[model samples]
Target: MLDHFENDMVVINDDANSDSVQTDDSSRLTTVENPTLITTTNHQVVKLQLNATSSSHTKCCVCRENLRDHAVKITFQDRDFIFLSRNIWIPEVARCCSGHLINNLLSKEAVDQNKPFSIRYQELSSSDVQLLLRKAQTLIEMARKDLVSMIQEILMMMNVVY
Candidate 1:
């Protein structure tokens, strides 16, 4: 998810092992500094550096999955108007495989937060009301036709067998 910070600082936590990068929001300009190496508890810190001028290589920021064909690019905008009027420049790319997982996690989080309940209730209630009305109208029309047929049968019987 995209997060806005004070002083035009925007931090995007893409995946578990991706490092946060700073960028200018408006112009989409990025400055690549030397990769800072740090040791982690579980995995070794392999410093993967990207040259400032390279293009057309796709990789998921979160899972580091190779995105050869389909990818998602997220752009963040600065929230605080005092910092700058432009959006943040951090561009994130995610592969099709891990993108679904990330989206599911986000959806699960929203459901856990009770966000889906309100939306679901509204949609279900409206459809249910419509269905109930249609059923009732159909029943009424059937009843009316049955009564008309009965009356017609009585009239025919009275005129016959004289």
Candidate 2:
């Protein structure tokens, strides 16, 4: 798969171990024109596509899984205490996933003292997800390279021929 952050493509295969090469022009995002689906060895299908701008994807931010019910949409104002002009829309779908985890945190802080149900929910941005995915991809590549180097060194020490 192509590194979402960089133009180079790093292909990981179970049998091959490491197969990475640089390509200038490679499809990154899936659009109507170029809708290509690539399947990895792990049976996970990755579709190179752009995010739907109309509504947020129904996936949990904390755990990249299908969101459960009991989600409520809350508006969060980014400021010390007072209100700010900027408004961030935390959709119901994404809110529910994080609400469960943060509910107790807010309770421990005694948020009720200041305001009722003062659970602050931040807006989930696609860029943040992209950056995380990029970081994961880079780490995987580094690990794969390290593993290959370690194997080669072990074999050399044993006077084994490939």
Candidate 3:
């Protein structure tokens, strides 16, 4: 198992008490050809998908267990948030056990359990970056609306009490 990856891979296996990484040379790295898969380098994640689940997913990417009929697609916000907060990169099309998610999103425990099994060279696409930007924009819009509504409610209360 480890023999195959020893050539062009960096494998990291981490437990609660210890962390181990093995690499022959960082400079000579091979590209992951699967367009729908996720890989991580030390600094960043590459090829993150921002939309729709892939039907080809048969196992949970996190647990690697044979998925039942109830497997759910991970959301883009949860995927990006994990990468942002924990540096755990999830494939855009990765599916997971329904138990791993709360309301179709990755939970703190789920993110914590997600460690980079293999390290591949980073490759970012323009569409991936643009999709991330769009997700951020949508979040900002929602936040702005919430703030306005909260402020309006406060003003109403103040006027009524005055």
TM per prediction: 0.23, 0.28, 0.44
Which pairs of residues collide in model 1?
Answer: 15-62, 25-87, 25-88, 25-89
lDDT of 1: 0.34
Error of 2 at 29 (Å): 16
Per-residue lDDT tens digits of candidate 3, residues 18-113? 333333356444333444433344332244332222223797766777899888888867777766555566666778888988877777787777
Q: Kindly provide the TM-score of model 3 when superposed on the true structure, using C-alpha atoms.
A: 0.44
Q: What overall lDDT, based on C-alpha atoms, would model 3 receive against the true structure? A: 0.60
Model 2, range 1-162, lDDT digits (tens) per residue?
212323323343343433342233444422222123222221222333322111235543323346567433322221111111112223333332445336423222222222212234343244544554565576668789999999999999999975
Candidate that would win on TM-score? 3
lDDT of 2: 0.36
Task: Evaluate residue 58 in candidate 1 and report its C-alpha lDDT on the 0 to 100 scale.
Answer: 65
**Candidate 2 regions with alpha-carbon error over 4 angstroms:** 1-31, 36-123
- Candidate number that wins on lDDT, 1 or 2: 2
True lDDT of residue 51, candidate 3: 26
Q: Give a tens-digit lDDT track for model 1, residues 109-141.
A: 211221110111111233333554565576668
